[model samples]
Structure formats: structure tokens, C-alpha cells
Target: MKASIASLTALLVTSITALRPVFRPRAAAAGPFLTQVDNETWVIGNELWNVTQGRTYGVKLYYKDHDCVGDAVGHYVSYNGAASNLNWTSASIVTEGTIDGSSYIDVKFTATEGDMHWIILSGLAGAYQYFVNHNLPTLGEFRTLWRLDNTTFPNGKTDVRDEALPPLSEYISTLKVQDETWLKPDGSGYITKYDFSSWIRTQTYYGVYGENFGSWYINAGKDYYNGNHLKQELMVHRESATGDAVQLNMIHGTHFQVSATDVFPDGKMWGPWLWYLNDGSKEDAELRAKHEFASWPYAWFEDEAYQTRGSVKGQLVLSDGRPATNAAVFLGDSSPNKTALDQGSDYYYTGYADEQGNFEFKDVRVGTYGLQAWSNGSKIADVTTSFLQNNVKVEKDHLTDLASLEWQVSAKTKLFQVGDFDRYSYGFQYGGSPYEHGVVDKCPADLTFTVGSSRTEDWCMGQSKLGNWTIAFDVPKAAAQCSSSKKNATLLVSLAGYSTGVSSNVYANDVLLGNLTSGGGIGTNYTATLLNDPSLYRSGTAAGEWRYFEFPFDAAVLRPGAANEVRFQVTRNSTWHGFMWDSIVLEW
Candidate 1:
């Protein structure tokens, strides 16, 4: 039988001692919403809905019946107890009754619409998959009730059918390590006046270094018309132990804000909606309080108009197409009041948009401002100034390209042996003899070797003269073991003894290997050389025995593929006690 390959050995070990997979609910990083042709039918949860605001988009909610008693005709009262056809906002107007005995409530707004960018529809009492469509919006007489009743749905409870409702993960997935997180404010954090005035302003941050940075305010209280309004800033903070990083360890919990765009009980506030959304609903308050991470309640995005430029505007999004919430927007260039556009200077201020992904630049000069939005420590989106037409002289408008950015996920490393938690007590010590072999004395009785989950007490070899102990195991020719992605691969090798610090030197066909160099103290290297084979293989402790001594070479020269021989070489210098090694896998 042929000796098993190194990659095969790694695979077998991993398989035999399979670790339970951790099911972490991550945000559904997806592609952004590409702008379809105007009025095209975009499908959300499989129910096709018409896009009304030209190509600019907004979500909608419809109801065909208010009460269970309605039977296709006759007038009925709405939840608000309104008589039926009372005009409210631009889109919320009660019109004639539908065959299902329900009045029509149209919701119309676009990403580019004025301050009113989004709407929420919460509190659908016992609503199931089947709902009635009373009418569709257009610019005609604006009065019609076309009922599409009893639309059967197979996965209504499990799938999200509304365009306004973000994915469950989006609402719950906290900013993970290396993932970007944009900061914004909850209106309740700051004190202010005016129920809905464009008068909110100011944002201040106290860095870890005791430095407080403040940015100019853009949109005022008027912009935060509904949902709990407050001045806020969208800052991007990285996650780290020493620096100012915003980490999503999941242990800290995800932070989000409730938006007016979400459906809520009537007469409720609107802002950014946040809470643990395990599957679909919010997380339990009692349990969440203990495990969930709370938003930085004191930090508020200013609700005051800090400044403004010549009609400059834009939007922001993540690389994965999700809206980059609460990012700070800034302008780079500006023009003197009524002066030539080219001769303008740059003015800068910051402001964040509401839940629909909007923002404003205050005190902005009239020329061209490099439109940049930042969240946490990362840039959300950046665009150049636009000067389209006369009426649109202020090139600032809806930014559609943001919906195309996507975040990339990186791969993680494998080897991890360097005494993970400082629990193992041992180190390298000096002995009187140089070539007479070192020694390891006084090993603790509780010493144990653990790989994956299998534990064993098979450690052999005495302590080094320096003091630290060691362990080694021969590759069982009868066993199939090892793994790797490389092709035309070869000899497998695994052994743990005393290293200068942490790691082993690997050799292949005596060519001097070149892989696994930076693999920390714990490393791996495989080969396809002879000496380690089957049918004509040599066994027992012979030439290859001394060929692989404990403390053979330095870690600086080890490589992966070209590695033929594996050995443990300890350093004679340093007062750093000693080190231990165990459980290695190698094959041919």
C-alpha cells in the first residue's frame, strides 16, 4: 500500500474529529438594487409591485379590507376612524370604498423625493398571506378601486413580501469583525425644539485619545418629521482592542434604529429601527438586554442645518448593495455666491439622511465638492459634483451608483498551536551538554494534548536541558491522512517537539522547502519525494531517525511544498523558560 498523502491526513483528522459548525446569523450581503427601466415591475417576495416615482424608488403597502366582516362592497371605517376619503400626505388619502369594503391608501415617494423619503406600515392585526389590492397610483383622476382579491401565497409567513421591509439579517446582523459599520443618531438622544423644523444641528465625538471632533450639521429637525427625530452623526469606527474601532463581536449585539418606513402602531415615532430580529420579529427585550449591544445612545447626528451648497445631493450604499446607513456626506468644492461656477472654492459640512438613505452638505461652496460619505472608519460612497441642466444647474441630486458597491469577504488561516491562552506552563532551558541531547524534567502531572476534541496522554521524550518538555508521534503508514489544495502533492509530515520558539522545519527531496514560513510557531509542509512511500518503504528508527533530530533547523528557512524532512530545533539562548509540542500528521 502507498503511504497516504499529507493533505489526505489532514482531511482524515478533521473528519474523524469533526468540530460542530457554528451557525452565526450574518447579514445577507447582496448586490445592490440596479435601477430598472422606469415603471418596470420589480418583484419583492414574489408579488410584483409597480415602481411609481419614475426610476427613483420607494416602497408601498396596500389593504383591501379593514374588518373580517367586509364582503366586497359597502363603505367601512379605517383604523384611524376617519370617515373614508380624507386627504393626508401627498400619497395618504382615503378615497372611495373597494368591493372588499376597504378604502385605498396610496404610498408614493422616491429615493430622490424631498425630505419625505420613506414610510412604515406596522400593526397589521392578524394579517395573513391573502390581502386585497384596491387601486394603483397614477397621475390621472387619481380615483379608482380595482380589486385583486384572494391572492394565495405559499410562503407568506417565511418570506418578506414588502419592499420596505429589509432582510431579517439586515436588521439583526451586528457589524462583524472586519465588516464596516456606519454610525447615525437616534432622535431621543438630543434635546431640541420644533416638531418638524429644518433646525437641528451639530455632532461631536470624543475619541479614545481625548480628542473631540465636531462636524457641521446639514438637515435640521424638519427633515426628521416623523420617527423619533434627533441630531445624529454617521461615524465609522473599526473594532480593535487599542484603537477607536467599532467591532461587531455579536457579543455586543447589533445596533439599529426604527425607521418611519417600517410598519408600526399608529401615532408612533420614526427614525432608524433597531432591535434583534432573530428570524423576522424583534428580539426579546429581557433576553436582549443581557446579551444585545445597545447603540451609542449619547451620540446624536445633528438635526440642525449647518450649511448648504448649490443644490448638491447624492445617496450611499455598501459594496453588497445594502444601504450604507448614517454615513456623513461632505462637499469638496464651492463657488462664491452668484460667481462663476469654475472660480468657486470648496466648503465642507456634514449631515446624514433619514432611513431612506439621504444626506445633506451644509455651508457648502457652490463649485464642485467631492461628495464623500463615511460610516464607522470606512468610506461608504464617493462621487464628483454634477452640473446637468439649467433648471438642474445644481448637479446635486439622487445618486444611483451607490447601489452597486459590494463588500468582499476574506478567508481565515488554519494553524493555531502557540499555547493559545498561556495556560500551558513550560519553556526552553539550558543544559551543560551541547551535542549530548537536551533534557525535559519535572513535567506537571496534569499536562494534556488536545486536537479538535480528542485528548490524549501519549507525550514522550524527556525535558530539554533548558526545562521545557516535548512530544512526538510517527506517521502510521497504515492510516490515510493529510489535506491541502495544491495539486501533484506528495509526502505528508507532522511532528511536534521543542522548537526555537514555535514551529518545525520541513524539507522536500533535499531541495530546501519554501512554504509555511509565516505560519506562526505552528506550521505545515508536504512533499512528493521518495524515502516516504509504501511497497519498498523503510521503517523503524534508522538513518532517517537521526536525519530528523529534535532542534534540527531554524524556523526562518522552512517552506511548504518543497519540504521533505520535518524536525524540532530549540534555541539555546533566551531566559524565556521552555515550550512544548504535540500531535503531528505527515504521510507519503
Candidate 2:
């Protein structure tokens, strides 16, 4: 009996010993097994763990708080490519822990086939949101914690684990411009980098070259105007294959100021710049970089032809003997019988008169040029007399001074005017944001305004699709009486912008004045479906140039010492017909 009992005890001990080995936990594998596939792609598993199609895999990201802002929350990850089933919202945080000194997060997702090309990360840190892109290192890098430092290297450099990466200039030197010259628009001529560079160097400006992630860029500095001006800066960029080339990219207006002269103010500089070129692939980044490098220190600036420049200075005075302050002056190629404003394929230079009405164009190319000037202020009377000065000669290293250019008014007497002549619908109702469809539909059907009592805001910004606007005024006994000796009254309608095939029918007391159409203006066909929302047209932003429509009518239409009405109705043609009015004027 004792031997049988001892045998049972021995058997129980053996079974317990075998089970103890199974319950003991094995040591966890040491990680981060990361391998870079390209600039933006990475392999996250060990060599034996292959990424197979239609399988599940674990994704781990190690993030270092280099800025020490705080731990980023609200993590999001996405798998890119057509084959990948995972999206931005698909992957969720499964676990969070620290690996070495860096914060690490683990996420689980179903693996895709060959179509899984990229992984993107985004999260919030303090008031700012941080984006981590495999391609855009400027935003942030997930691999090895690299960040951009411009002061250390030109074209920017990235540091990985305390090691500095090579600057973008080192890579850009290998690229070459394949075409001899790029064809200019309108089939006018061909343009080379030399042509652009030469013109750029003539202006006093600041510049810088930097890299954001894998993309390279050049900030050619802002224009003479300080803030929020149209076409303010000149910029060139070499974007990555996945980068958005259409979106305007901005930089600090003052941070990268490399020039001694302060031409632009300290603020955010807006972009789309002047030029944008894309790198077709990761390997093609160098090729795109070539254009940005070529413009820096613009080689053509060294040529004697570019160095030889002259200056043009002048003062503007209105016919009433008042200084035309803030008038815009332009210089264009000397073409006989052509105004500077009409030149299409010439180097254009612009300047503004100071408060004292004095203006000057510096570093102008040595050549004869046609000069044109116009007041920036709203005109009370018709200033239709041409200010075009033909064959204004400029010699090399000399100043061409034309003291006091006179601007004459076209009409002998002023009758009445509605809205300002500032070539914009800024002060009128809905003018501040008029780039939308269905604005005319929202306006009052019987829109009427009395001339003296009506404010600028009472006028609608634009008319569209058979909409009509009425202007009411009392005709004085002396001015309204028709006489054989008096000249015929003239009506002028100025448009800030318009759609194609737009026209207006003008009537005085139901007498047809004329069917008015745009003489010359910026025309666009907004083909998008009318959503009746503000975003239906141009996203509520202003663009394009002004046009004029004139009508001459007999003054007999006016009744002496009585109420008069001048009505304008858009000619019905198509659904998208429209025009933004700048001013309406009547003169005798």
C-alpha cells in the first residue's frame, strides 16, 4: 500500500512540473524593427514577418516630443493607395507606452496587397495640430525624428539622431533644363530663365531658398506694397510628387529676409507665388530643384545689359490743378500709336504717386518706353482723356524726368453720378463679397435708389439674369431744358467685371438710350452648377479687370423741374449672364 501511494505522488509531481513551464511567460521581443523603403514608405516588421496580401498586421509609431510641447492626443493613421481598404478613420489606438525615451503607440489594421503605398499620421498638440507625412518632412518626420533647420544649411537641412542630412542644393546641381526656351503665352515669343532672372535682379528685393520635407522652394520676396496687395510676391517651388501644387504655400515674410534692404513688412507672406513645378517621383526631386537653384543669385544678373539701367520720374496733376495723389503709373515698350496699358508682350513696370503726387520708377531697362498714368481715387467727373505718353526715351544710367503730366477731363459739365469710379464694387451692397451665384435672385425685385439721399450701400454690387436697377433724381429747370446750343447728354456705365455674353439695356423715362455691352474687360464662363451658396462662384473672392460701356442720348428726354428715372436692366440671353458695376455717370 505504501509503494502504491508513493507512485501516485510521483505521478502528480511530474504532471505539475510539466504544467509550470507552460504558465511561465516568455520574454517580449525587443522592438522597433523599422526599415525605410523610400522617402515616404516604411516596413514595420522583422525580416521573417512578411507583409502578405489579405492579412492583418500591427503598426507601431515612435514619436519624440522634440518641441517638448506635450504628448499629442487624438491620433489618426491612414493607409494610402487604391488597393488599401484602410482609411484615415480605420486605425484606432490599441495601446500606448514608452519605448526607450520616445512615446510609442501601437495600432492594428488589415494589410493590403501591393497597393499599400503610404501611411499618414496626424494629431493635436496644444492649440496647434501636427501632421506627419512620409513625404512632407517639413510638417514632421516619423522616421528617426528629423526636423528642418534652415540656419545650418541653405535649401534647409534635416537632423536625424543628432546627425545632419545634406542640403537640397547638393542634389539640385545635377538637374538640367531640357528645353532651350519655354514658349510664352499668346504665341508671342519664347522665354528663358535668363529673361526672368534679369528682370528680377533689377528690382530691389530679398530672397531665400529652403526645403520643406523633400520638396524645395525659393521665396523671391514681396513687392513694394506692404500688405495684402494683389500679386505681392514672386516665388518658385519644386514640389514632391504627392504635394499639393495648386494650394498656395506661405512663409514668414520677415523670417527669411536675406537682403539688407527691407522691401516687405513683417508678416505672413501669401503664395501660389509666381511659379510651381512638380517632381514626378522621389528621384525627380533633384530635377525640380534645378529651377529653384538656377534663380538664386540669378546668373543673368551679372550681364552688362542687365546692369545698365535708368530711372523715370514724373508728377501728375488733374485739370482742376489738384495733385493726382496715389495715381498709378506704368512703363511699357515704345510701340508707336500704342499705349503702355495695351502692351501685351513687354516688360511691365508699375509705380504709385506719393501723397505729394510725385512718382519714380527705378532700375528701368535702358530703352524708350510708352508711359501711362491714371488716378487711383474715385473720379467725380469723366477723366476719359488719354494719359498715354508715347516715345518717352530713357538713356543708360540716366534719369528721364517729365515734370508735371496733366490729366484732362472729357466732359465740359457734370450732371449726375451713381457709385464711385474706382474700378471696383467695394462700397456697394453685397460688393464686399459678390463672387457668388444667385446674388441677383436675392436682391429686391423693384430695386430703386434716389440720387442724393441714397447711400453707396443702397446700390447692388452686380446685376444678373434680367435684373433691373432704377436711379431716381429731380431734373433742375435750367439744366433739364433742351436747347439747340447745348451738347447732347452722355451716359457712361463702367463694369468691374462680367461674365461672357453679358449686356445691359438702358432707358430714360422708358425711352431707349441704347443696348450697352462691354468694350473690354475680364470675362469668365462660370460653368459650375449654381448651388445658391456663396461658394458657387470664385469662393467669394475678387479678381479680373474693369470694362466701360458708353451711351449718348438727347437731353430732351429729361423733363424740367420734375422727377426723372434712369433704369438699367440686364439683357436676357443665358442663365449665367452677369456684370459687377463700378459706376454709372451722366454728363452734358
Candidate 3:
């Protein structure tokens, strides 16, 4: 086992904070959405809906990661009220279904049209360590738009407006980051306006930065169209010192407004959606209160101009021609934008194949795009004409249907392979040292799959370790041993040729089971357990004592059933000779 692979990762997010106080009703980290299979594995999901302007939407509620797999569950709440009345009503996530080969859940809301409803999505899964580089976008869409189109100014300036507003009206094309937060307050060029004579002229502006947030305004709110002038720079401050050096053009958009009136809930005044997704943290609150994370509140990505020309539909299949449900599919245009295209592009659009392997891309601009599929981080093989060989064309006025796309990818690691999180989601822990060593076709093991390309022998010996290596299993709830009334369970460990000066201890439900420095026959490389194994037919001079040690654990440290967590570990503080583990057994 590589020491690099044994490090622990922060597995869940806890809270949320929106742009303002009113955006407060938006849910934040509502406790970690996770379920542990064992101490070794678990899954997480989150809500990520991209509502279009027509309210017709497509969404990827949870982004997949290396280890997590499952579909996101959503609910339509407030049964008693009308559509408009229930738009902001709060609700809980009712259920979730697993997607075949994908890591996260997906939903395309076009089929559920006419329902203008509010939603609360579960969260996504991953080992999120650095907030600064984590792909989860805090402020995806930072832009400006004119609320009302084709308006005349009191000065008789017809269409005397900013050309910059057009880009903001569309989704993702003109998206900008709040990286360089503060605006040049030196009356810098604010040129996207036209003087009354229909003659375009440049204006000047200045801005200020707030804690975790900031903004820029046209200098003096210049006289034009009765203060309806849409010359502003929308910005969003990042939670960390710096966001990704390259930002993603990924958030499915709903509002691409360069002006205030364009926001939904038309009757409102002043600010855009002033929401705060309460993630139960002051720092998170302060961060969210400072900037707009895209068109969050009006997240519906739509406009009459955005139609078939910007949309696409397709299907997916496995190598065997069956529906490849839940495979992660990505579309991107190296020319328009780059994304995780692995194709060297930075802009991209993401979604997953549904139960039938069907998929769609909403709110796309007219351009050429390439498609890619992935399952648990490994790229799936495309058996058909190479999607990478030719870029698919997404023209205006029509939906590009590629018929059916095929993907081929599968898990390779064996279930019994030590530290394998994908299979036995067990409580496996390691520290101090990492190594692998064991007799082939000798020791009894539980893993059913083969290790690597060839199997030299049948049983797992362990990884070969030189410096130091450790392995511990947190007995899962299902195979718990201390459940009966007698409650006393003894864990027997088999080892061969281990380093000297080894110490042992066990933990149940996180409670320590008192340390035990001595076991059955120490000093010799072999413990009592190893000597008793009938399978150990030493072919050559035996390396170590090849012994076994038994540690009796009392009921006080172990939980009967509810808190069924059994942890055991062994460590060699000083370097001498490394070791090999044959098997472990629990006797009541």
C-alpha cells in the first residue's frame, strides 16, 4: 500500500450562505448528507438545478466524485397551494434512487413543465479539502442585464444602450469572475451607453469592496432613461484568497441580467435576489453576504431567443448495447469555452444519462461541441465513431440529436483488496507505516476479485512494506461481534515475520479498550495465532515467528447494536523488520 493513498479527506460540507439577507430562506449545508457503508466508504448528494427562462429546466443536482455513486432525490412540496404560492415554500428531500454507472444523480425537468415550483436539492460528494481550488462554484454567474428590453429614454435616445448588455442576456457566454474585485474608481471608462442623440458615448465609474463581497456602479448614476441606465459591473468575491486560476463556464443559468428589472418576482425594488442559504456558519454567512453566486435566485436559464439552436438531446448505451444509465456525460467547445473537456478546453457543460440513458443540454450558444463520458473518474470508452475525433455541431433553430452514444467503463479493484473503499465500505485505518506482504494461496481472505492483471497465488498476503505500514478494520454494523448478551469478543490477529517492539489496542464505538503491550508469544516474530494455522506449510527457512495474538475485548467498550463500531490497530514505533498479515477473526 502506498502511504500517499492512505491520507484521510474531509468528506462533507455543512452550511450555505446566499447573496443577501432575503435570499436567507435558501437552505445551506443541512447537516452532512452522507451514509457510511463502513468506516471505509460512504456517499453524498446535493441540489444543483438550472432553471431556464421559460421555466423549462435541466439539472445536475449533485456533481459526481471518485468514490460516491447514486442518484439525487427531489420533491415538489406544498400540495395545498397554487404554483405561484408555492414557489418559495420550503420542503425536504423525500427519496433517492441509484444511477447505474455514474457518481451523482441527474434530472431533466422539461417533462414536468408548467410547474413553477421551489426546490431543495441534496448535496454532492467528494473529498473537499481546499475551498479555494474545490470545483464547487461559490459564485458561478457574475454578470449584469437590462430588466426591460427596447426601452426609450426621456432624452429621446432610442436604443441608446450598452452593447455589453446583450452578452449578459445569454447564459454562460459572458460570465465573469469577481477575482479582481474592486473596480477602478478613477472615473474609468464605463462605455456601454448611448447619449440621447442615439450617439454611443463612454461613461466613467468607481466601486467599493465589502467584507467577503463587493460591487461597482456607474459614476454619478448618470442621467439616462430616468435612472434605468444599465451600466454596472456585477461581481462576486470568493470564499478563499483566490478561486480556481481558471473558472468553470458550468452553472446552468436562469438569470443572465445586466440590469435590475430583468430579475424575477418583478414587483421587487433595489437589489437582485437578496438571499442567504443558511449553512450555520458566520464565516460562510459573511462570505455569501458579500457577493452574488451567479443568477442564483432567478436560476432559470431561459429567454425567447434561446431555443432549439442552443439545446441538444441524445441517448447513451453500454458496450453491450444496453442503456448505460447514470454515466457522466460532458459537452464542450474548445472554440467557445473550455471545460473539464480533458480535451484541453477550459469551458464545458455537464449532465448525466438518465435511467433510459437519455440526456439533454439546455441553454447552449450556437457552436461546435465535443462529448465525453466518465464513471467514477475513469474515462469511459466510446465504442462508436470517436466523439473526440469529430466535434458535434449544435446549430440554431434545431435540436441536435446524436441518436445513442455508447460508454464502456467498469470497476477493477477486488472487494477484499485492503483499503478498497469502493467495495467493503469498512472501517479500515492505517498510520505510521504502509506495506504489503503475504503468502500466496496460503492465508484465508475475504476479497473475491483478483489483484492487478495476474494472480500469482490465491490468498492476499498483504502489501510489502519497508519503512512502516499499518492496517485496521473498524468492524461494520452488519458483521458486528459484540451484539449478544454475553458481549465479550476476542479478536485474533495472524502475522508472520513482523518487526519487534509491536504494541496493540482496540476501540469500540470510539471508546478505548485499554492498551495491551503483551500478547501470546511476543519477542519471536510469530504470535500464537500464526503458529496454529494449518495452511502455513513453510517451503523455505521461515522469515519470522509466524505467530498470532489474541486480545479479549469486554462489553463495556463495544456497543451492543446501535453504536456498533469496533476498531483495532497495531503499531511498530521503532524500525526493525516489517511484517505480513494472514487473516483476522472474531470469536465470541
TM-scores of the models, in the given order? 0.17, 0.49, 0.25
Instruction: Give one digit per residue, the lDDT tens place, for model 1 in 1-588.
Output: 012222222222111112221111112111111112123322111011111112211122112211111111211112111122212123221112221332222122222111121111122111111111122111101111111111111011101111111112222223321122111133121111100011112311111101111111111112112111121111112212212111010100001111112122221212221211111222222233232123321122122222222354555544445565554443332332221111111123345644545654432323333443333212322211112112212332332222222323112122222111111111212111111111233333222233333233333322223222222222222221232332232222221212222222334323333222112433333321111100001000000110111112232232343322333333232211123322232222
What's model 3's overall lDDT? 0.29
Number of the top lDDT candidate: 2
In candidate 3, position 555 carries an lDDT of 47
Q: Which window of ten consecutive residues has the lowest lDDT sum in model 2?
A: 137-146
TM-score of 1: 0.17
| Candidate with better TM-score, 1 vs 3 | 3
lDDT of 3 by residue, 1-588 (tens): 112112111323323223110001123333223322222222222332111111111111222111000111111211111122112211122222332222222221111111221222334221111001112122212222111111110011112222112122222213321222221233332111111111111222111122222122221111111111111111121112212111111111211111112111221111122222222233443444343233222223222322224667888766656665555566653332322211211224556767777888765646677675543111221211112313777787678888876555322211122221111111222210111111222222223322233232332343222222222233345545424455566554444334333344444455554432333434432233211211111111122223335556664554433424344344432222223443444445
Best TM-score among the predictions, by candidate number: 2
Summed backbone clashes in each candidate are 111, 2, 70
Q: How do these models rank on lDDT, best leading? A: 2, 3, 1
Which wins on lDDT, candidate 1 or candidate 3? 3
